[model samples]
Target: MSSRPAPPSPPRPISVAELDLDAPDGNVLSLRPAPGGPAVVAGDVYALVRLRGRPAATVIGTVAAGEDPAEVLGALARERLVAAGPRGDAERLAARSRPVSAGPPPRTSVVVATRERPEQLARALDSLLVQDHPDFEIVVVDNAPRTTGTRDLVTRKYADRVRYVREDTPGLAVAHNAGLAAADGPVLAFTDDDVIADPHWLTALTAPFTADPGLGCVTGLILPARLATPAQILLESHGGFAKGFAPRLYDPAEPPADEPLFPFTAGSFGSGANMAFRTEALRKAGGFDPATGTGTPAKGGDDLYAFVAVLSAGFRLRYTAEALVWHHHRDTWQDLRNQAYGYGAGLTAYLTATLVRSPRLLPALLTRLPRGLAYARAMTAQRGEPADGGVPGEHGTHHHPWPRSLSRLERRGMLYGPIGYAKARVTARRHGRNPR
Candidate 1:
């Protein structure tokens, strides 16, 4: 017999406090400062409460049981109701939020997980060496590569700033965990070896922590170094987050998210491609999960999961659009397709896990599926059958043409997130193996 469906959950209490302020739409939003005492930021909008300061029961997303906490705080921040307090407090908060002192500053460590992409790895390491934020160490966790050139290049050229750790383990999380152990710093910053950081990447990434005592994790925006592929063009056109974004924070707390949320606004979610974490919080959550990322059958949701865990544990998670990096997009169609499938699978696993934790989610989950598929189809169809490209600006970008048809197709596929997870699970079971 088939298993019985889970019971529906009761409506959650309002997780926020009513504040006396109007929203962006001029609607009044009830706001409350997060419970367990606020971290006085002086001039900032939200208080930076630390993980240690909060009760064990209060996860990052938990509400205070009356109104939406994030909504209220955001409204206050926007209205500038949050006082910077005194001038001394503002400078202190600013000092804490800024990057470590520039010359021979605190020893910040960077962890990188690399596979066969030697060129990408090289560029990433080069960027680290050039950061305006000084006094940092580099740890390159070389996953089981087909060749040993990654080790050779690091040791020969970037030996002073780098240490090579070899993890025969194939998963990205495993490699990252290995790096975590190898490095020693108050803060741990991570960047994909395939990405290039801006000169201010480290400084900007570390800046927020100093501003808010409660800040535990920070993420930055990712721009495509090359948005030349039909895959990328399609992805970005659908608000691919390349234009800088943030997440909603107070949408009825259920799980801790890597991104923040607003009552009516959506921001960019945290990308593992560009993120940093306080060393202590990173360790408490047991690092990244190996079962749900690119190196596994699920293909890639570990970064967000880790961020959620941190927030759930009562640590503040942040996204800094200013701390930017340029990631190289896959040029080939097959690679792009695979990447899309992998992305879908990762999202599915994340949502599925959420459903298991909170069964009353049928309304939101089911409602979102078809909308996702419709988006994918429309994106791909923009590719317009066979074409050299499209009319100027039709494909996007100030330079080059884009295939509108395929762009729509990819967007539509994203909506079928649940379907992708199902397919991934089936493939894993049938093959009894995970793809590399």
Candidate 2:
């Protein structure tokens, strides 16, 4: 008969405050000692609560084993999720680790705002279906599709896990609102159907709320699925969608910046491809302004506007790199150019919105314009120079000057975004199109 190895020495026993999970469906979990298993019961979810109610030292999920609990907690903390585990000795740990009195957990919802792409959408749905967190439901809002494959894929492979919603509206933001209205989760995560989320994406994305009561939203890092194209490489080189940390609820009214920018910024920027928000927060923010996103000629910026509103409402925003997702970048030069122009247009919209509220930021635009032009000119001249023997390469410019210039102009344009948006608001009023 096969014998199992002796159980490892038990770490110092610690006490968990108690398992308390208030699920949204009127389910309540109370921690009660189980006869032969982990202490603490939460309906189907049982907690072993080892080492004095602390998580076992053993690591879980796709991360490497023997990983430091602190690092794991950091990953969770980055997402602003609840993280409570032992630190030093059992006694020392007890002083700091406190089990949170969790209110009813948010019924998280997933919305995939998709365009015409089907293959990528299939991959994204596959990832969503395989998520370890199962409390959530998904809505794939078809945004004026050129093909019907997205609907078909959902009906076939993900019939159990997904609900397909078709929004004839052509804009990405509009499609997202349709999904938001159709969803039931108190918290909502919106991802482009073109991206693949790591299995832990949902958990990490929702962790922040568990830690801080005030946290209203979470944004995760978006690594590229493939960085083969020159445009993709260039975009990454310039830190596309990769943002420095910023504090969201930081009342400039507050005394000092206590936290690093990663998770707590007013404009906690992240790719629309990988971001989550509380559903109540979305409702309060009025469900993504359609004028700012893809529905308009401007390709994107809805996420930024939503982030801004969440911060303005005095809620915290967090960025979790461990909650990773991969986005497929446009492969062709033409696609890249189109993306660049669309981004510029979107920034134009965002800038216009920002200017009306904070007029002082208006000067930042003028300062950036000269610097942007200088960089563009220098890059253009270098690309214009022949690769060898003064002969121009087959591709007229080794690095296309126009896209790069347009990218710079777009960034510069953001400095003016608020002013421009405000101007547009006034102009729209005269034209009978309500800008607000």
Candidate 3:
């Protein structure tokens, strides 16, 4: 007879916290509760370790029932943080992380697209209000909102500081375009309504554009704001937005050797939540496709499409670790399931949109399609020992073992992507709108 398989472990709650390795006490931990969540208590803990105010690493530990959450998490964080780097290195990074080549960062407009999530929007707005960058304006794009909550919050509380624009269209890309059209700054930065930005985020993100005039786009780091639930922890374990801690430049003129897919692998550059673009460059390439994003049949690929469009336009793209945000990931298991499928759908949808937008790149994409499909298979396969040996990822993605179910969902979504994009295009045409 065949041996019986082991049952899966029961799901448990986890607490989230932040620790600064360079703090005066060097052991103080700031515990942050998830949105609408209860207070932190002793249990599994997830902490974002910072050195000199810059995110360095993340560590997961357990706080026994009777143990103090702070002390337990702080000690584990300190040990792992040391492995990240010594204090001197943190100091140097801090010293060098100034306004790059600056008289001052260029005047920029920050765009936040949302749909009826008032409380979360408030948190993000609060953080944005404190950004250290000197000249910047905030624009909130209400995307097919069902209620006036977003408008009321922006008007009642932040009437003076933020500009409100309404995009009746349902897609995230459409809302972004509405904000882009309303913005007056030379640099346009886009972020979601579910993030807490660092004080220097704008400066670090926009400064590169000034330092390198040829640069058309820049993306920054996104760390989890909370890992309070099983879904959040599991997602972060395999690198939620894991783009390494180092800075890089993606120039179309000089494609990277390691990336076999080059610009087609645009998702590798960075995520949309922490990306900025030059106003002229984005307009020239045409803003995000209206049919591709959340709330559309495409289900998401707007950001990926934009990244490739910028690169294909012969502009350089930069990825900076210095600019950072804390993203509040979806909390429930069901939400994770939806996200997995949606990600799969979005990726292929973005590829479809890319080909539709510029047919010239189809040949290059076709050449890589075979390898790309194989790579996708491996990515969605059940996670066991990592392909990169058994070493833990410095970016904190290897903490929890992954389930094959989520992988399967992503693959299913990939299969449906091209079909979804077709439906979305058909709908757009029926509505007498050109998504391009």
Candidate 4:
């Protein structure tokens, strides 16, 4: 039997809270639980500050045992949010009040891919069923199940509200592809089984498609569902999955000046946890690459591959912070270590998949290779003095340094990416599916 040493003791847990700056009263804000998280408590708190129901910023605050958490967090939120100035709040409210178009939002199919985590799946499904979207359907893709837990849950609990599909193949891409095959609506949105989506998520995600005929993909903001653990705090402190509050449209016709790598800088585009696609565009681009993503030797990259694929097909990608989902991050150091390896592996594997599947993009990738390499170094480098170079952190910028050990694991994953991808491709072939 093999013995693995346990990690050191973790830090004090920080409770996750949601602070709406636009609460009925000015400073009389009530700190609420993050979706799927516990109630507000006096200790360290990580809050998602929303101004007028829009995610304004995330700020950290502390409250003594005797002090009220809401009061403490409210003061911190007001002070920090004020720093954003009055114009910012006005614009956010304006944007919210502004309509996308005269017509209704597109009909949508939301895909929730899962495996053995029935509890998480159920929580995610409950959130999805309550979406404010005018028209939508939920499809639960049970990926490579070890038992019928997911099937039973969907059939018994969400029979009428949610549709259930199963993929015997284990890979995340394969599972998503299964959902992709079953998706009926013109617009398809994909979120993980561990998420608690905002009520307006589906509406916000699909609205762009109806408003912008040329847009192919839409991705949204992802905030930590829970920050009650050190690993989660560490990850969120480094940006977690939340992209900034700024809405961006990446039109291949004209790349942004800030991104020299353009479409290839897909990670910055958005994450898989909160992404949607124009059904026809994704189908035309060949759906997701089965050789990538979790559950495969590739560790990850399924989402990244699809992002690049859709973009390369000459369609634009939009990112709106308005469409949000709360994600439950891995809570332990080992999980973090695994994530680091997966992230690194998935990056390279997706890059490899992109080139192999769409050979023409190889030239563009080659031209940007040098700069990409430089960026990778900066990303895996230490924190600040060395940083992950990930999305800007809460309230803006990081609070903790990236660990050198995790960085090394990530680098090793990058090295194994191509090999792992190749292995996954072979596995797919043996299983009677097309990996390419």
Candidate 5:
């Protein structure tokens, strides 16, 4: 007997169009799809359009089954739902037309936490000195440095514009605490040595705090410095530091729905590279956890922990896409793999710490654990694959499978995170006793 014919292969996803809703001339968009190619479903395809370099809209279209993705996108453009043009044109237009704040910007204390990357530190310092916001100071903290090279460099090159401090502690949290202690401004902004702040970074970051005294934390957009390498592209495709272009306010009173982990999905809040805090609120929340960041066993989740702490303390957290910074990603595949592992380990450690510190949240954490695991697995499986129709902008056509070995390594790290965190706690206690 002849076997039934193999099931027909699934249709390949298509790259439809890029829309610019904030463009100067008008809303403009462009579509590129091969004729007679795969049919696209309207619900499955969408564009992540930006306004003034900030995530503004996630535009999804409704196309009939078996219809051309390009035609549907074009029709949407005509309806003025989205403008036709290249990806960043709208952002540029918004930048030019955007109005300045009426009053003087607040005094912001910019902190740069550095270890051994002196060259990168120099670039970061340079960016800070030229910020459009006038009333700000740069605080450079050299964390557990083997030598005084960073301090010396800062003294020689930026003595007039920057305040340099040295924290002998190795952990990122320790360095942050040191910076916080030294900062004089009411608003403290933190960026890594590997980041270059936009000229308006300070202005944008501090504005929300001035407008709302209740806001405790603010995170900005982090775009890639360059996407010329494979690793960089893959990292952004997997999920970059950018939260979106639109401004968002997260009030504890009005918690988001369907987030099983409420605030614990730390990565969603923002990256450590471009975040700011109200000095009073951060200090009251106890600053960063010494055991949770880089240079410690946890290897990452300090930023996440801080976000949760700020929210738990009854203060608002705002994500302002306009406060922009460019981050230099790890260019090598090995470094990227190591980063992935750190992320997994960090997340697990953060969860463990949450349970230990606040047992009341344990029930909520437990309720969310299974769903979290399922989401993690789903993300791993869909790492490089595009949706059935397509993803808008660069993500639509771009696909890169995360190496299986790397994915496994990250999973292994997640398994080890709790143990790592425990060890780190023990070490921290020992250090506390020794006073070294």
Candidate 6:
């Protein structure tokens, strides 16, 4: 045995390339080793190697060979692949490797507002049921359904786990309110039918609330489910749902300064698809506006309105990037165009409603109008340009071009928004539905 020493192990392969971590629409690049690569896992350390005249490459600390390549890359990236430095390298590695302790997580009620998409709802439920967080319940609000399909599916497949409710009212806000009424948990979370949440989503979302009793709302990050189609890429280029990769806390005492649009630009706070709120705080804000949202005349802006209300009521809101969700984008070109139109209409309507409800804020809003218009023009001009090469960056400012017709449609929607909002208000009044 001593005469014939064992042969040395083969050297592991190192992969060095620029990772486009932040594509315009929140899509990460798909990088994988050629074949027979090393295994990659979460909490693995990597060094950023910089060479002259070349993009930086990641010197992988672990070879995650023969596994799902995309999964490995994503895990490494999320764990923050950073360059080695003089400051406390050992401590960082230990912190990353430490297992998260399990404790009694707060009970949360997750609301899924769906209209006609049973297939997508099913997929969303599948992901929700398997969440690693222990204490949670699912409330599926079938909003103005033409058929009993969603109810029947939920009863048959998830009766033990999910509570199915039929909200005859036709609006995302209405459906959300219905869910709020039905939920029993102290914390209520909302997500769309088209998103698949990460296993740690609930834990990440609720942790901030526990740490700060005054925290009223928490919004998570939304990444694209896939980027195989052109429309998906374009939508992402136009600034996807991701606010930013960094965690942010908005203290009511120290509101953001120098922003042209403060509360009116509430969409920047976070998206509706992956947001949670304290039940009592949301009720105090009067729930979501029934005149807004997908099924209403305003076509959207309910989430933005809610954000503004929460902030105006003097509660803190936070954006936690770790609470992740993958949203399936509209696959067709026409759908994408319609979505763009909806966004403009929704935003304008949100501002209009704000002015109607709170006249005192008008002075500030007027001051911001010129700057807002300028920003909109800049956005229009940046359309169709190539995105910044997959480098990690801020969200909500990227501009990808839609067809000329689509752009025109969005502008038209913006012009019509105030009128539409007026009509919606009248309709809501008629129905005795005033979602403040």
Measured by TM-score, the strongest candidate is 4
What's the lDDT for candidate 5? Answer: 0.70
Q: Which pairs of residues collide in model 6? A: 25-236, 37-65, 38-63, 38-64, 38-65, 39-63, 39-64, 39-65, 40-64, 384-401
Question: What would the per-residue lDDT of candidate 1 be over residues 119-153, giving only the tens digit for each residue?
Answer: 77988888878888766778998887789889988
| Error in Å for residue 426 of model 1 | 13
lDDT, residue 405, candidate 2: 54
lDDT against the true structure, per candidate, is 0.55, 0.55, 0.80, 0.82, 0.70, 0.69
lDDT of 5 by residue, 101-205 (tens): 646656889888999889989987888788899798889999889987898898998878789898886778778888999999999999999887877788888
At residue 370, give the lDDT of candidate 5: 85
Candidate 6 segments whose C-alpha is farther than 4 A from its true place: 1-104, 258-260, 383-405
Give the backbone clash total of model 2: 32
Q: Candidate 4 at residue 335, lDDT?
A: 91
**Steric clash pairs (candidate 3):** 237-397
Stretches off by above 4 angstroms in model 1 are 1-106, 241-267, 353-436
Against the true structure, candidate 5 reaches a TM-score of 0.77
lDDT of 3 by residue, 1-436 (tens): 9988665553465666665655522655465553334566777666665655665556677787788776776776665544456877645544543335656789999999999899999999998999999999999999988999999999999989999999887888888888999999999999999998878899889988887888899999887777656677677766687575667999999999999988888778999899999998898889888879898899999999999998888889999888888899998889988998998999999999999999999999999999898878877785333221111222222224676778888999999999999998887677655876
Estimate, for each residue in 1-436, the C-alpha lDDT of model 6 and write its tens digit: 3687554332222232223443211245545321122333333223222122111223334434456544555445444434333335423433433333535557999999999889999999998998877789999999999988998889999988999999987888888999999999989999999988767787778767777778889998776665435567566555667675446778667867855466666877899999999998898877887788888888888898888878777889998666777788787677887887898888888778777776777897798888888776555444433332222222222122344565666777888778878888777777777745
TM-score of every prediction relative to native: 0.59, 0.61, 0.87, 0.91, 0.77, 0.76
Ranking by TM-score: 4, 3, 5, 6, 2, 1
Per-residue error (Å), model 2, residue 21: 33
Q: Can you give the lDDT of residue 96 in candidate 6?
A: 32
Cα lDDT of model 4 by residue, 269-351, tens digit: 99999999999999989999999999999999999999999998999999988888999899787899899899999999999
Name the lDDT value of residue 294 in candidate 5.
87
Give me the candidate number with maximum lDDT.
Answer: 4
Clashes per candidate, residues 3 or more apart or on different chains: 55, 32, 1, 3, 11, 10
